[model samples]
Target: MLPSQSNPNPWSESEPAEWSHYSDLETLIIEGAYSTKQPQAILDDYYIDFKQKRQISNIDSNKQRPIKRVQRKRDDKHLREERFMDLPVGTGRSFSGEYGWVSPFIIEVRRHLGLQPDQLPSKDPQLIPMLVEKAAQGIITEAIHIRKQREAEKLAEVLLEKKNKKMKEVWQCCAYLYTLESFLYKTINAAMRLIGDKDHEEVWRSKVGTLGPFCLLLWDDPYNTKVTIEKTLYRGANLKPEQIAAYEEMAKHKNEYRSFQAYTSCSRNRKKAE
Candidate 1:
């Protein structure tokens, strides 16, 4: 690679704990060389996790479906339980019944996108168009899986038809952040809200914990590499003394890394950060 070209991170010899949730295929792609160009087969693998695909296959071959559990988000008591108390607990045999005996992940996607229980996106094609911009490809992949699992093969086909639609949106959102994050205040307020004792930790964990690492990884890679390389970054500015103190309370010494859960902001512009 040229000096100007990115020195892509090579596959790690030891697997990372962060990647434990990734399927074998996903791991292979990440753990191996970063291929800038994606092939069609790789793209196909991008949508549905291989393990989930295998589960569906096994269900077909044995004619005996194993009882499966959708991995629950941590600390679901605050947001999911309280906000989504109306989530139906029963199952249904058709695609039209999203509220029916569907996986919890499906319910989460619906809720995240502001859909009603038992409301199928099929009934409102405009709903997909409206959400396509904000929808992450990974979540859409889960939706596709449920659609397929329900014997509503056609809906899955439609969802997969333009797999990159949501992906492009995600890319754009990331790109927007790269230039300027007007949402910094919103993000800071969110961090401020997350600051607290174990109960608050549980609530935040249940709500946005799944996104925390990925968002951190995104923030780390590009801004550090593309924007702030060899440049100074600042924090503890514009923040109230209490907010900074809160961060100090939460900070922990993790090996060489000082890990803190919340209560600070980072910026390249020193004055702006302050």
Candidate 2:
């Protein structure tokens, strides 16, 4: 008869301690607060209260705190006594050569079998087949587990499909919420960009063709790709190793240098002519 198949429990025995602690902290902070009040505002109030209490305690403590004196001489003597004065005698050779070239494989096999490295019958060729058989059995067991896992996953997918079909309203609500969030995000981003562009234009007008600030503002403009600036800087002055490397990478696809071999060949020919 075939072995009885059982579904393994997917959930762990306990929720992670750190996650539980964080949830408790969140609950504590949000407890009794109006939903309209921001969490950050509440947290800031709590922080200020804590700091005021700490300042009061510091002001109240007039007397100097007691300082512990260290006995350096005694500590030094103790450390010296504890320290190793001499190294152990070195053996001429460490490893046994008896096992030959197969020693490493033997050690690895023994480790997988939960045996000590020296426990395997390294000299016996007959035991090799037994080891191979044991390894094959382990592989077969793992493969069976993997097959069962795939079956469980397929079953889960089918159940999920049915659940999703039943929760059409819930899915619609989620989609609506996501759409609203995305719309708000894009609106805010667009508003910020408009404000920034206006500010940059005002700054550029105030500067009125001033080289440094105008160049900086020009570079800061969203429309500018900065490729021209990068190339100009790369050619004109010494740059950082990272900047040089980036330029080299960008140079690869540029019209001037299509490939490393092309660049190298040109350089080599120039050098040969020189």
Candidate 3:
């Protein structure tokens, strides 16, 4: 036959039980539910405040609550797993197999997070794992924005250079036209004065007197003329040698054998008419 159990309650027989003598019925009703087993004795022995105990219980419940795992994207995962040092500077993009601590970027992020210098984690990999996706997203967004801004600045600089080049070409062309016009005026005046002189035939015999204007028109000095124009027009420009030679040849062929005096007379008459 089995030994007779002394305890009346079946639960008390299987599980260990504790007894408390309550002074008042109100106290018993209030504390009875929580005073079961050995827990109440441990609480009492430690002199733990009821409110503090409740707070501890609350903390335990919070610990038990399920934490939602952040789902990382392929790119995000790569960024997180990769060494910050391997990421492209000023861009959030990651390179293949790049692993290292990007000290500057990490420092920047820590500053943004309001973390102090001493509070920075010893290891980059260890700290990165705890970073939420949102925070990482902010860092990436800032990096991308910086990259775009830099690109825009570079584009602006290129456009400005192009504009300056075009302006220089226009100025060179204007200067060449002015010089050509001045030469034409001087030649016309000399021809008009010499045409009526008794020494007109003699003047024509001397090539210097008759062809002086043509020589002046073909002046190709490095300091003040043809070479200067070439250098100015082609400065910092992309032009083939053949292209420059072809242009020069074309220029030399123009206005050949043209009657300068006759053209000048016509131009003056046209101006007077206007």
Q: Report the number of the highest-lDDT candidate.
A: 1
Per-residue lDDT for 1-274 in model 3, tens only? 0011223342354655433222121122224434553232111112112332321222243321111112222343222222111211221111111122222223334455565655422222233223322222322233243332222222223223333233233234323332321222233234333322344534422323323322222221123422222221111112355545644665597553211121122112332222
What's the lDDT for candidate 3? 0.28
* Candidate order (TM-score): 1, 3, 2
Give the number of the best model, judged by TM-score: 1
Q: Tell me the tens digit of each residue's lDDT in model 2 across 93-211.
A: 11112333332222333444455544432333333334333422332333243342222222223223333232233233222221221122122122222211333334323222211
My TM-score estimates for the predictions, one after another, are: 0.27, 0.15, 0.15
Q: Comparing candidate 1 with candidate 2, which one achieves the higher TM-score?
A: 1
Give candidate 3 misplaced runs (Cα > 4 Å): 1-184, 192-198, 204-274
Model 3 quality (TM-score): 0.15
* Candidate 2 overall lDDT versus native: 0.26
Task: Give per-residue lDDT, candidate 1, residue 95.
Answer: 13
Model 1 per-residue lDDT tens digits across residues 6-93? 1132233454312123322232332232343332112222232233332123334332111221344334223222221222212111
**Whole-model lDDT per candidate:** 0.32, 0.26, 0.28
Total backbone collisions for each predicted model: 6, 0, 2
**lDDT for residue 152 in candidate 3, whole number 0-100:** 25
List the lowest-lDDT window of 10 residues for candidate 2.
258-267
User: lDDT-based ranking, best first?
Assistant: 1, 3, 2
